[model samples]
Target chain A: MTMTDTNRQWRLKRFVQPDEILGEEHYELSESPMPTIDDEQILVKTLLLGTSPAQRMYVTEERTFHIAVEIGEVMSGRGVGVVMESKHPDFEAGEIIQATLGWQDYVALTPDDKSDTGKNVRTVQKVPNPVRPLTTIMGLFGQLAFSAYVGIIEVGQVKEGDVVLVSSAAGGVGSVACQLARIQGASKVVGIAGGQEKCDWLVEQGLCDSAIDYKKPGQDLAAAIGEHCPDGADVYLDNVGGAMLDAALQNIAVGARVVICGMISTEYMNPRPDGPKHYFNLLYKRSRMEGFFVFDYVPRWPEFEEQLREWYSQGKLKLVDDVFDGLPSAPRALGSLFTGGHTGGCVIRVADDPENIPAI
Target chain B: MTMTDTNRQWRLKRFVQPDEILGEEHYELSESPMPTIDDEQILVKTLLLGTSPAQRMYVTEERTFHIAVEIGEVMSGRGVGVVMESKHPDFEAGEIIQATLGWQDYVALTPDDKSDTGKNVRTVQKVPNPVRPLTTIMGLFGQLAFSAYVGIIEVGQVKEGDVVLVSSAAGGVGSVACQLARIQGASKVVGIAGGQEKCDWLVEQGLCDSAIDYKKPGQDLAAAIGEHCPDGADVYLDNVGGAMLDAALQNIAVGARVVICGMISTEYMNPRPDGPKHYFNLLYKRSRMEGFFVFDYVPRWPEFEEQLREWYSQGKLKLVDDVFDGLPSAPRALGSLFTGGHTGGCVIRVADDPENIPAI
Candidate 1:
């Protein structure tokens, strides 16, 4: 073959553990030129990226759903980028695009986000990031925000004076759920966090009415939820589904609602988790438990974004991001979620502005 | 205190397992010299009596709940008796009474049932048995029929062409649930039985569209449900919530509903059962699992009953009773549930007919 350079890419040479870096030299960068666009394709430049614990698990070859990345495959992630070139009528050159974009510096365009194509294809929606910080929308407000909103408001169906329990209370989805339950009129939000700091943060943010530190070894979460919420939890926003789901199951109030969001506890295991153990409490308490994927709420996003923005303007929906500052550090920050590295949303800083892409 | 003569009463002196009959010898028969009635009470004459597995499990001390006989308590059960004397306005002499009349030939005044001295203390619905069988109305049709009807029609919300899985398929609740599911628009019904005989009977009675012998070692029920149900089950009437529940969980189609009617498999354990290991399947499958106590649907009994009686009259509802003659074999029949010793509803033949007695 002729010596022609190629498209910019973050090639996944091998998987790494939590203690290991993705390596500065791990990614190979080259570009012959930008590709000519089609009527349906839009070329977008990488902007800010959202790192997830799932990505870390995916990278380590621990997760089952993922096919182990071959010797050279692009690192997977969801990110916000700016359209550099667009032939698609819906997208413009300068317009922003948010997608499950991989760790590459540049990615080709495709509207089929859910497909297995190498490009980070997704149902790209224009998230107006001018009113608030774009970083929040990219990090806290988008993925985690919608996760909490859909899980709590819709799935959990929280009501006024109702008690709510959120596992991984200081993490992305749980924190957002805690805040949303309060906004929606939850009487008491008891958070289950990893440490005193996180628990303290939860209570201080007014997101939680009380907090139980899981890091303290054994904080009888059921007892705490029972004590602080004498009425018992009407809505349980479960992010950590294994033991926390079991604990919440025991203390479920009559007609309680359990929102199954994610199970981070079992996500890192070689085998999936065993029984949550206390789910029979659902039968005894006459409660209902349901699961939801945030992507299922995309059509409702405009409505959610409107209400969420209103809450933000009213200081009801506060955003938090435990952002790491570099592409090389992305894997480490994302790994923190499973390894207890961060206390909030794990987001990676790819670029400060949409106009900062260097010429090839 | 003056002691009365030996009164005819069903007493549980000790707990016994299945096949071990707690015969009349195990009970101390007493003959009362016509006791006087008191305020808010009515004396009743001996009449028809039957038994249920719940009472059997309780009488045998093989259950988690405090279903103990208290060393000499009348074996708790439901029966239809005649009122000879009445001091309570709601109940009068010569009026028949139906409460959780403990396993006794004749009960004294005070229509107390549970711990409640007054609540749920009245006759559910006074009845004059005519043709189809009084005990059938009082036993199978009373709670058993209602259990199946309420679960499939009320909770499972069975729809036309919906596939339903009934665990403990040959037992009381399971057998009834299968029949009710078929009646309530279910096009396909699968019954998980303990043996080939039970499976054959289930299919013969048209209780299930398909049957699986759970007693067969190494039978993959999940695979069977998947194979038998190509579209997946829309409703699951689960009476045996154990490993079978795990299989059901895996085979549940998206939006499928699980009606947790009973958990016979795990009921006897001192410690609570560790349910299906893959319960989070509820989340993955976007399913809803709900448990309904038959007591909760009592108010709707008139509506439910009118329809049920209509079904029974139309020969739409199947009455499966494993009748054990006399109170001697009652405990043995009751204990048959755990061992899968009997098929359908089991009733104890206490009397040929009931007579109305006058109030004190």
Candidate 2:
């Protein structure tokens, strides 16, 4: 069978101003020759694409740990896909994989490429023992799940009888974090989300002991948290860091653990917003606020994967996947993360996996 | 020998507005009968009164961990005094003891009373083996030293080759912290202070590798810190937590530890100032900012005391005592802490130690 002649890609056309919307003006859709693989490489067919707030940092002119997504280049991101053709021994043509698959439908990954430097850092690996509903690879067993593990288990160190609070609790990582906190023996898991719908879903699905709809105008954030967590939060997994973080700070118990996973609230500001005005509460309560990157824990992903799989099999965990239709919907999927459009793990369904493997 | 007929006391008359000076208007000089000790209590003759910025909190109407200092009450404080007479077995005449002696010449410390509650909380104890220049007991080997121990060795976790930065580095806690960070094997210890004199003193005394005079007109604090800590600060011991904290946050290295010992810069403000604006750097650098109270580590004071004494005896540490004369100077000494007027541990020399004790 002959593959399509041209590759479709969403290239970052220019660095968007923080005040500007990340739309087609900043990103351009382009068609190019399909990427050719070498003897030690594999060509991947993208299946599912994950969207994260951190992606906003990639398109900025300022450089972070990874290089900025350059103008006229494929926007870098993580995704789940299947190996279409492989010249590498570790990967077969039908095997599923997850890596920095970027914005293209197809990607040529060199399994033996050791030159991941400044501007060229790619993490392409074959998925081991593929899970059913392959989106689980990106939503639960992949980077998203790994980040939640790092924040909940490592950073927050949630323990039995601890009152755990999570902000943006209906979002991708927040959803998994709430479940993980419960599985780790937290006596009370409280969630804070934007709308009543997401908040209702959190409590109804038993993901949290209670949920507070922060967008409910006239409702005080700290007061609501105090009402739900009578003893105050022992571990606060903060994804949205603005007024919500300030509120979390106010309701934290003495020696509370505040895990700064993401600051989605201030990510789009031109000159960053004023910091959490209640940060001094950290001093008053003798609490700790810490931040981390999931990449630091990449070496231990296998351990996290195994534990997550066990939790899933025992019916103690659920992956709330909110998948958009096709590759063209990827940008909107990413945009929706900022607009609070999705309830759980927001991902774009790129294409269907080959039917050679037996369905679960 | 018969002492004076009356006891001199400074009573809190009213809560001073943030803009007003903590002067005679806020306090009233009063005379009262010397406190009588019960059979289980010891009579203490106050010798050295230590003044701290935390005293401002005591005068506030707002209650925190401790109750507010009420009007007509003797100003609450910590001091070193001699046991004038003792009915309690734990104390003896001529022995130096540390306790919440308040702003009075005499204090009745009930060593065996054990009825300390609410506004009567007294942390009274006999000074073990008494370090020389007895002022050292209240300065370096007392709570000041304990705070530095917690900030430098415990919270900041200063280690070999770590570049440690400190704010208000000329004051009591910060001065000791600078030395402790160096003794803990920090390769570079930088300090930020007001005026050229204190900055020069820090470098001349080898207390800091370099010093930034924050009060220097038009100097960009972040740029100053960046220039001093070329590789960025590995640990930041924050005492003056306002703009200096924001600057420190901006110049921290990846994985840096920020120890928030105090926020003297905003303590007297009726409405607290905005928090450190560069706090998001904690997320960007994957760092940690933690706070601790010295009282929390009281059980470990023996360890800290032993180490501090050893360093003092070995000439590795020095107590930069900024002593004001007489009980009347206590309020000014406390006021100086916020005005950046004192170079070291500010204390009021209430009276001379008894001649029975040898002057070393």
Best by TM-score: 2
CAPRI docking class of candidate 2: medium
- How do the predictions measure up, each by TM-score? 0.87, 0.96
Classified by CAPRI criteria, candidate 1 counts as: medium
User: Model 1, range A204-277, lDDT digits (tens) per residue?
Assistant: 87768789887676567667667766767898887777777887788888788888887777655545667767
Query: Model 2: per-residue lDDT, tens digit, A208-291?
Result: 989999999899889999999878899999898878898998898989999999988877786877777778888888999999
Reference-based lDDT, residue B187, model 2 = 91
Residue A152 C-alpha lDDT in model 2:
98
RMSD of each: 5.4, 2.1
- Please estimate how well model 2 matches the true structure, expressed as its whole-model Cα lDDT: 0.85
Pairs of residues at least 3 apart in sequence or in different chains that clash in candidate 2: none
The alpha-carbon interface RMSD of model 2 comes to 0.9
> Local distance difference test, per candidate?
0.70, 0.85
Chain A TM value for model 2: 0.95
Cα lDDT, model 1, residue A338: 71
Off by over 4 Å in 1: A1-8, A14-36, A54-71, A112-121, A139-141, A218-226, A355-360, B1-7, B14-35, B56-69, B85-97, B109-124, B128-131, B354-360
TM-score of chain A of each: 0.84, 0.95
